[model samples]
Target: LHNMRTIQHLPREKQMQKATETMELYAPLAHRFGLFSIKSELEDLCFKVIDPNSYKFIARKLREKKEAREAFIEEFMDPIDEELGKQGFTFEMKGRPKHIYSIFRKMQRQQKPFEEIYDLFAIRIILEEPHTKEDCWRVYSIITDWYTPIPKRFRDFISVPKANGYQSLHTTVITKKGRKVEVQIRTRHMDDIAEKGVAAHWKYKEGKEGGSETLEKFVHWVRDVLDNPRPDAATEFVKDFQLNLYQDEIYVFTPDGELRTLPQGATPIDFAFDIHSEIGERAIAAKVNGKMAPLRQKLDIGDQVEIITGNKINLNPDWINDVVTHKAKSRIRQYIKQKERQKAEEGREIWEKRAKRANIEISEQDLTRIAQKLKFDSTQDLFYDIGKGSFDVNELYDVVKQFTSKGRIDDKEDEDKPAPVTEEEIQETYINAARSISDDKALVINGELTNVKYSYANCCNPIPGDDVMGFISRTGDVKVHRSNCKNIHHLIQTDGERIVDVSWAKNIDSKFLGAVKVIGEDRVGMINDITDVLSKSLETNMKSINVSSDSGMFEGILTVYVDDIDHLGRIINKLQKVGGVKSVFRYE
Candidate 1:
């Protein structure tokens, strides 16, 4: 339901998007539930909005054909009327033109021009209450005797009503003038049920005996569709749902003679899934009509299907394209996703092993950059490729080494031209410029006073982009403490209310002092290599660097300027890859 007032408030693009989502979801659901009126109206509105040119073309074609169609329908129904009158059948007949969207679908389905399609309307013959379905069949025989009925075009839904309780006799006959016309025969009660679906089912069958069983089966079908797990993709789900539940049905059977109804074009694999998920997963082959057949063979009406199973899951992802049922598709999608996840994990382990062997210590942020540079949608995609053997891990290692190689990039740019810097360094430069406006830009304090002095706690030396909490001290100052600081454990427990939720501001620029301990073999130029990696490679300004040696082992702690946690991590990674470096750890 599109409220004009509410829709007017949205931008044109957003309105279009909402219409797409509705068409992709609710419209197919309406059709599946036998709500023909609602489904047609919904399709009409969505078609106009989604493709106005096509809608206009179909509407114009329908309008142009209306008068001629009426004449043809009249000529076709006259002989049937005379025959029914002679047979003394109480019936109501009318020529119902097809809906606009329906005609368009017919044209597409037949792959023909609009004028070439002759069966544009159906003449309905609704018998009165006294005339039961048996009489309707007799009437159908009389009509077919007068006209040449196409054997393939006849359906006896009156014998076995549709899952949604629609009962009718449908036939397409060719007249002497070589014009084709469609006809429908049903009782008045069946007509009502066909139009109004469940509502009329309960109304006409208030105390009826046979209808209770049909209604129970109909209810069960609905529950089966709804109660199962929903598919992840909405568009795929809607298309598959329509194929499974709304389209023409084929009645197949098991070897035991039990009947089953599946969508037209359903494969034997779909029959396997309809029986049980376990059977579908384990199905290896199939037998149709007491003869061995391929599992992908499409089933037909009255075809007996038997599934041959194996001990292990014999499912293939390619079967997703062969089956038409939603349950089968959903199960196949789950298996595909599970396999991809396994491959992705394997890829990650391979990458980590290669990284360790190459002495390449890197951050996730840098890995994400390499993933983006490789034109992957996400790091997970990159890893999946690696696990599948499509991507070379050494290629990723080369990218990481270049990323930490003094902020250098190996793209096709002039040697003197400025290479594209990483997002972190760019954000740092931008934040340095933006923070010049205000001193309190480093930490945003809600409802803070003008004289509220802000200071970084010495215990953790919280920096920009560090997770922190603000505590109001007795000196009327706001002190920022790192979220993981051991010193704040007592403060959070004793004076917890004084601790307020705090986060780093994006514009924060001021540097906080951080310290890291690095241990390596005591060798010549060990301290120089560490200092050079910090001050020159990563561009970190060191406040102090101290080292002490015992025999051939040495450990050193360096206090340095840090803009954020990520910056500190990059520093540690750079130091860990230095020559003779055994380990590097940052201390709070």
Candidate 2:
């Protein structure tokens, strides 16, 4: 539902986070257990949001060649159809191109254009019950006899099944017409287990002979993935797990003669993590087959690896690039992140002391601007520099004072740029009085602290995310305006005494009015599509949708109740993706 982009109740930030989790963890997990059907669907759905342009390109290319590809597949399978019929083989044949995401990845790996991909097509041949393992081999022999088999392209999983117990005879062969095609031959029972993954495995588990080894391997593989607890961020997790999904495996041994399977090119760090999380974190040195070798050395088949541990945890950040498994990389990154956070906390304490001693109070918005001017991507990074002694705290105190003394922002570039949905930490505590806010609910704070009272100026109607200034009125209430608003600037220069420091409260419990304008080619169902996106995707409530159409062109103003500027921005972005909608922006 979230991937469909219809679960709009989730904020854009949350949606992005969910999409990343699906891409990095869930989809690949499905693939690991041979749930290709579910895996491919999940990939395509998440791909729509993660990289829309690439998804559209692949989908469009597939559609354009659909008819031709179908004809070619029919022509290619005709000979096999007749041969199988003559041999009285009871089989079901299916011809299909690979999934959209797999093809895109293939293009990326091979560094080739979409048109140049030859092995995009595949055929699956499934035989009925009573078909023995020899029958599968006979089918493979028949196919190879018909076409030239590509070396290293054949996998006889029937003989040595995967950890998931997926058994099939896979081969890529060149047809008489000079086209490459992948082929899979399996029995009905094997196909069932392959399609259903763990579910089918257990279904056939009862009274099944010699299934214990395969089940143990399956359990171990799953345990290996769960070795690392979920981390703060998923970037490293995704990078490592993708290798598990596609890369070949190598079998290694421990000192106790226990065999471990790892992704090809996996290092000692990966091996240690596979054995146990403790050994991976406290790993000091490793002996590969009783010989001291660098941890970065790639393990080979049948090599015995012994990891050395110590009392102290010796995790290296540089090891992030050295390990191929997700567990090792995730643990290393978590360590670095935890250390950085500690430094940032220490820096925050230092800043609070300096600010309190100097009698200076700067808004979170102003601090962010100050951080950017000092070439920091985020305020946390700036403070991190301070904590590590790389940056001077007194210098920051001076910067904050300068910003607070300035009545308003004078930089035109800063005012014109859109306020991002950035997360920030404010030194001051905010009051939970959102229900007392006025109709045009712009966030307000820093007005005598506890008895804070403010309303948005109708002229600009600045929302929570927009950089704003508060002007004290004769009525003892603050009137907030966008810092760039001409009304606020005039008052700042003429009666500067009323210009007071104001920033958005950390939380918003009230809704504000925002107007969005969209223009596009007019067509049937276009209005419905736009409305569904606004109302359903983010669960945003609308006051009214005023629209006009002429000469097959559509223009509309979406008047909606939004929590903040960031919420409104999310709505506009979603509107921009509607099929007939070409332009979407906030209408001031």
Name the top TM-score candidate.
1
TM-score of each: 0.61, 0.53
The sequence of per-residue lDDT tens digits that candidate 2 reaches over residues 1-588 is 345445345543233445556766678788888887778887877666444556777889889999999998888778888888888899999898888888988876865557778888789999987786789998888888888999889877886676677889999999877888999999887888787777776665666635555766788777766555655455456566677776777778899987677888889988988888888888889999899988888998679999988898878889888887767777787889889989998988889898999888887787888888788988899889988999999988877776677755445666565554322211121123322433344444544343456778988767777666667675556677766456765565455555555667766787888888888998999988988997789898889988999999988888888998779879977987899777776665
How many clashing pairs per prediction, in order?
A: 0, 2
RMSD of 1: 26.9
Candidate 1 has an lDDT of 0.76
Q: What lDDT is obtained when candidate 2 is compared to the true structure? A: 0.76
Model 2 CA lDDT for position 117: 83
**Candidate 1: worst 10 consecutive residues by lDDT?**
427-436
